[model samples]
Target: MHLREVRSNQFKLLLIALLIILCMALAYRLLIVRKNLKIAQQADELQEQKSHLLEQQMALDSLSRQLKVAQQDNQEELRQKQSEYNQKAQEVELLKQQYIQQRQYLLRESTIYKKIQKSVSTPNPDHKELLTDKDWKAIYKCIDTMYPSLSERLVLAGITPTEKKYCYLSFFQLDSKLEAFLLNVNIDTPYKNRTRIRQKLKITGSEEKLYEHLALWG
Candidate 1:
């Protein structure tokens, strides 16, 4: 009986030892599962953070490219405006030069015209002695028949009689005024032909002096 009692107590101790070992194994397996789950969750969170950072980096790069493009456009626009301004300035300078040349040309033309007018309008003293009575009567008759309206004008100018030498008729223009009349009692033909006489009589005072002489004689 003593031996049996000892065996029974040993059996009870062994069973308790086995139960403790089993419980320890189960606790270790549960702890291992919980650790693996925590590691997986941390890995997922890290991946999400990496994706967000990458998206932010891409957005910043796009914005930088746009800024560069805008700056380049502004620079090109400024250059174009500067070029236009320079072209206008050159045109203005050219116009000013043209105006100056035109003004100078006009002044030169005006001076030449004034000199021509002065030369044509001056009277000759030598032509006064060539008139005569017969010449006057012939000129008066011719004027009355050809240009009656000029009689008053001719009378207003001075005319005198002298010895008759020759008789003639001529048509002439003086300062754009036309004269058609008979010229009487001249020593020599002052002009060789009709064209020459016309050209000579174009002298400014010739028409006025001739009219005056004819009026005095009449």
Candidate 2:
């Protein structure tokens, strides 16, 4: 009976040892599963970060392309403006040349201009003294009709009503100046020269003596 009881006790002890070993094996399996799940979660998070970085890189590339296109457009516009400015400058220069050519042509076509040019090139003292009595009458008529007050003033200054040939010659020259101006002849003589002549005549004290010695001409 004691031997049998001992065998039963040995069997119970073996069963308890097997149960403890099974529990240990299950705890080891749970630890391995938890470690594998943590590794999967970390991999997923890394993939998401990589995708975000790729999206940012694509956006930067798109913006860079747009900036390049904008720069090209601006350069084209600037070139167009420069071309237009050059064209306008050329047109203005052409207009200036045309106007100068037209003015030169008109001056060349003018009869009075030719006469004055001829007179300047070949001066003739005989032409100055070729005035006839009719020409003298016309000169006196112009003075009486156009410059009555100046004629009266000259007569009062004792420069008129004289038979001196130089005095009549001076009067004819003065009348010729008026005719040149009325005909729009572009002589270098300004009206100031006429004023100087009149003022000199007004200031002269002795007209007969002045005419005799050609002092007035001097």
Candidate 3:
């Protein structure tokens, strides 16, 4: 009976050892499965992150392309505007030059007209003798009939009873191919006074030449 009881205790210890080994094996298998699941979750998260980064990169590249295109378009527009402005400026400058030339031409014409009017308005010495209005009018009529346009100029030069004895009359032909005649009158007087008068009448062009001719006669 003692040997049987000892055998029974030995059997109990073997069963306990078997149970411990089975528990160890099950725990190891469960840890390996949990580790594998964790690894799979990490891989999925990394893939999602990579996909998001790729989308962002694509969006940035598209925006960059658009910005470059906008810059190029702006540059082209600026160049066109600059070219147009230059053309307009050149045209304006040309117009300014033309305007200046026209103004100068008008000024010269005005000056010539003034000189002619001054010559015509001078008083005639001969008209002083014809004090009566009717007589003066008749003399003016005669002068107009003889010289037409230059009648007033001729009367103003020296046409009076006092001047009749000293004044000589002549006509001048101009070289401008116009059918115009200049009436010339000379005052012959004391030689010294005549020289003074001649010097005063020394003008330009045909008028000067005529004055010199009259002086020679004096």
Candidate 4:
């Protein structure tokens, strides 16, 4: 009976050992599966982070392009404004020149302007008398062009150089402002016929004077 009880206790111990081995194998498999699951979760998180980083990089690139475009537009606008400003400045300068010219013309038209004018009756050592047949022709051309109304009424009488700077031109008397000087000269007249009426004229453009004329004719 003792031998039988010993055999029975040995069988129970063997069964208990197999049960312990089975429990140990199952715990090891559970631990391996949990570790694998944790690794998969970590990989998924890394993938999501990579995707987010790519999106941010794309957004930054787009913003950089937009900023460049805006800067270019601003520079173009500034150039256009500068061009307009330059054009306006030129226009203002032109207007100022015109105003000054008009003012000078008005001042010269006054009778007191003659007192301040330099006389051209005196001779000049630097220049010779600009008198020649060609000059007379030029004078006639000027008269016909500038004084068309008086061209038909008058003819070239005589041209005598009063000085190197002044010339005397005689014309038939007319019922006009004889006191005022007539300086538009045109000697290239087709009319070579001489007139009995005579007039002397002295005209000046040099001698630091604006154009002036004095008629010493009846």
lDDT, candidates in the order shown: 0.42, 0.47, 0.42, 0.40
Q: Report the number of clashing residue pairs per model.
A: 5, 0, 2, 8
Prediction RMSDs, each to the true structure? 57.2, 53.3, 54.4, 48.3
The candidate that wins on TM-score is 4
* Cα misplacement distance, residue 176 of candidate 3 (Å): 99
Model 3: lDDT to the true structure: 0.42
**Candidate 3 per-residue lDDT over residues 161-192, each given as its tens digit:** 43321222222112211111112222223233
Please write out the lDDT profile of model 2 over residues 1-218, one tens digit for every residue: 99999999999999999999999999999987885575446434534544454465565555555555555678776565555555555655565455434333433433333443454445444545334465456445432332234455445555534322234334323344433343234343434343444565654543443222232121
Error of 2 at 17 (Å): 1.3
lDDT of 4 by residue, 14-44 (tens): 9999999999999999988886576456445
Cα deviation of 144, candidate 3, in Å: 99
TM-scores for candidates 1 onward, in order: 0.32, 0.30, 0.32, 0.33
- Ranked by TM-score, the better of candidates 1 and 4 is 4
- Which pairs of residues collide in model 1? 132-162, 157-212, 158-212, 159-213, 166-185
Once model 1 is optimally superposed onto the true structure by TM-score, how far is the C-alpha of residue 60 displaced, in angstroms?
Answer: 1.6
Q: lDDT winner among the candidates?
A: 2
Q: What is the lDDT, from 0 to 100, of the residue 149 in candidate 4?
A: 33
Candidate 3: residue 47 Cα off by (Å): 1.2
Of candidate 1, the 10-residue stretch with the lowest lDDT total is 159-168
Error of 3 at 92 (Å): 56
